[model samples]
Target chain A: MNTKQTNEMQIEFDSKSENEGFARVAVAAFLTQLNPTVEEVADVKTAVSEAVTNSIIHGYEKKRGKIFIRCIMQEDEIVVSISDKGKGIADIKKAMEPLFTTKPELERSGMGFAFMEAFMDQVDVISEVGIGTTVTMKKKIENSSTFRVSGDELNG
Target chain B: TGEVKRFLRDDGMIKVSRSLKEIANKVRITKDSLNGTLNREPTLEEIAQELNMEREDIVMALEAVGEVESLQKTIYQ
Candidate 1:
């Protein structure tokens, strides 16, 4: 098997809902070399969706701006990093807490970090007020061969 | 994806057949990690270790569940 390819893919697009979905598909396809399962792909895609959504809605405050996404694949693992140079969060701890949101008008779930944690094994958020925010996420492929579906029963 | 406790369908194709337990397991997820793949979110590695499934298989499974849910809903009246 390939030792794993690590490279960064960058794309700047409008902070829009539709574009967020597009980015996820594009990234997933690009990372197909890791041979990620459907579920694994979906998991990463969701996390990306959440991060990009955060960048657009919270970081840019829904205003016109740019979003950057990077993907890195290492032996048995894939790392994805998302960063936005918009108004960075002063308190990442507070933003990560479930149900905590700075904007209620957007119906923000505030579960972005929670979801990221739930999906990825290791996730780190780096943010500097007035600078930008970067989220580093990693997932090991070796973990997949071990998730046994317990007591799964399919019937008509 | 997030706590994918169970997958109702087989091979991530379609839940053409599924028991109550299976459907409940797939539908009763507190999160949309699997269903919300259309958007780019960070990658979640724990699911592989927890579910013992390949990344592609997991996505297909979850997408199947989502499709099944929509199918069942459409059958209504």
Candidate 2:
């Protein structure tokens, strides 16, 4: 078995509509150390924005609450988790369906989860009604020619 | 009936929807014939065609008319 190094960062902020951009940029900046490609940065930014926005609009329902974001950097992958203590989803399956929004009056479009799934390699959503919801996403950093080949060379 | 929050655009125009698609649909219109100069109300498609831009791009810009919270106000630990 091979042991891989890991690093983590966590942040908590109010569930305000405006923090969506902040959360997106902060996650992108943190991933900069990994030397991700432009597309990779954009993918993470969009995914983070969706998750944070969902927490603000759907979870907290615009009420005052707190949102937590955690990023874990593994050997060649990054894992991101966005969680909130707002009203949880009663049916996560229906919520994940594209164009299915609980708040249609707000014109939410219900594309948040779809965008997250499209941008990231893996997306896991866990929720319990009346409790809260958490979204966990992961993506492997590609275009890392330097580290990728070096790690393989040492093994060969 | 519950109250719906109305978000104002940068130019003081109230947006009806938060989704880009909805905004695009709402803004789409046929060429108007009010005057010889295209009725002065330019549709997004016409503007895109005239400016050599993508209609989707124009809709994306128009959808963000709502106020966005600044990052400086965020509380980080």
Candidate 3:
């Protein structure tokens, strides 16, 4: 099992709801090299959507800021880290609890973390109050043989 | 007083909310059945076709209900 990093990409954009779709699509497109199945792609897209939405709505709290995404494609897995420099979460344990939201007035679902955790193999969050939050997610592509073929072709 | 009046006057909003909730429930059922049949997680488009609804509408309804459901939980719990 080759776990070496094969490719990497980074993107930065405004923390806005409009870019939520863009962010997820961009990451999904980047993951295409691994030839992930449709379900794999959709799972990553949903997780990305939840993470980016949290960065915009909860991290930035609608204020103008920057959201950064870094994705690294390994031989059979992809790791994505989304970060935001905004008002960070006070208690991450409480924040990750299902159905707990600090912005009820905004009608937040509070299921963002849950969705991310459900869709990805692993999800890690790092945050500091009044500083920022970073969410790192990883998912394994069960059948990415095409990437191996392409790699061999390139080497040969 | 103003909040009460606004709530009363927003009948259309309430209706839309109720309809979205109904659609969300249908979407859940459709997704579950599709998962069993397809042997994998179905896409939003597949779920939409199963329910005979537009993909965009299903997405909107699901998201709308997510917010409302969370709010309701917060209120009751």
Best by TM-score: 3
True contacts kept of each: 0.09, 0.00, 0.00
lDDT of candidate 3 over A61-125, digit per residue (tens): 88999999999987878999999998998899999997888877654467778777877899999
Which candidate would rank higher by DockQ, 1 or 2?
Answer: 1
Ranking by lDDT: 3, 2, 1
Q: Report how far off residue B10 is in candidate 2 (Å).
A: 25
Runs with alpha carbons beyond 4 Å of true place in candidate 2? A145-156, B1-77
Ten residues in sequence with the least summed lDDT for candidate 3 chain A: A147-156
List all candidate RMSDs to the true structure.
13.5, 14.6, 13.3
A-chain TM-score of every model: 0.83, 0.89, 0.89
- Displacement of residue A71 (Cα, Å) in model 2 is 0.4
DockQ (C-alpha based) per candidate is 0.08, 0.03, 0.03
Q: Write the per-residue lDDT of candidate 1 for residues A1-156, one digit (tens) a residue.
A: 865445556767887766886677667755555655655666677778789999998888888888888877665677888888889988988988988888766643676787777667888999998888998888876544322233132112
Q: Rank the candidates by TM-score, best first.
A: 3, 2, 1
Per-residue lDDT tens digits of candidate 2, residues A24-107? 767876675565775577678778988998899889999999999999988778899999999999989999998889888764
For each candidate, the alpha-carbon lDDT, in order, equals: 0.65, 0.70, 0.75
Number of the top-ranking candidate, with DockQ as the measure: 1
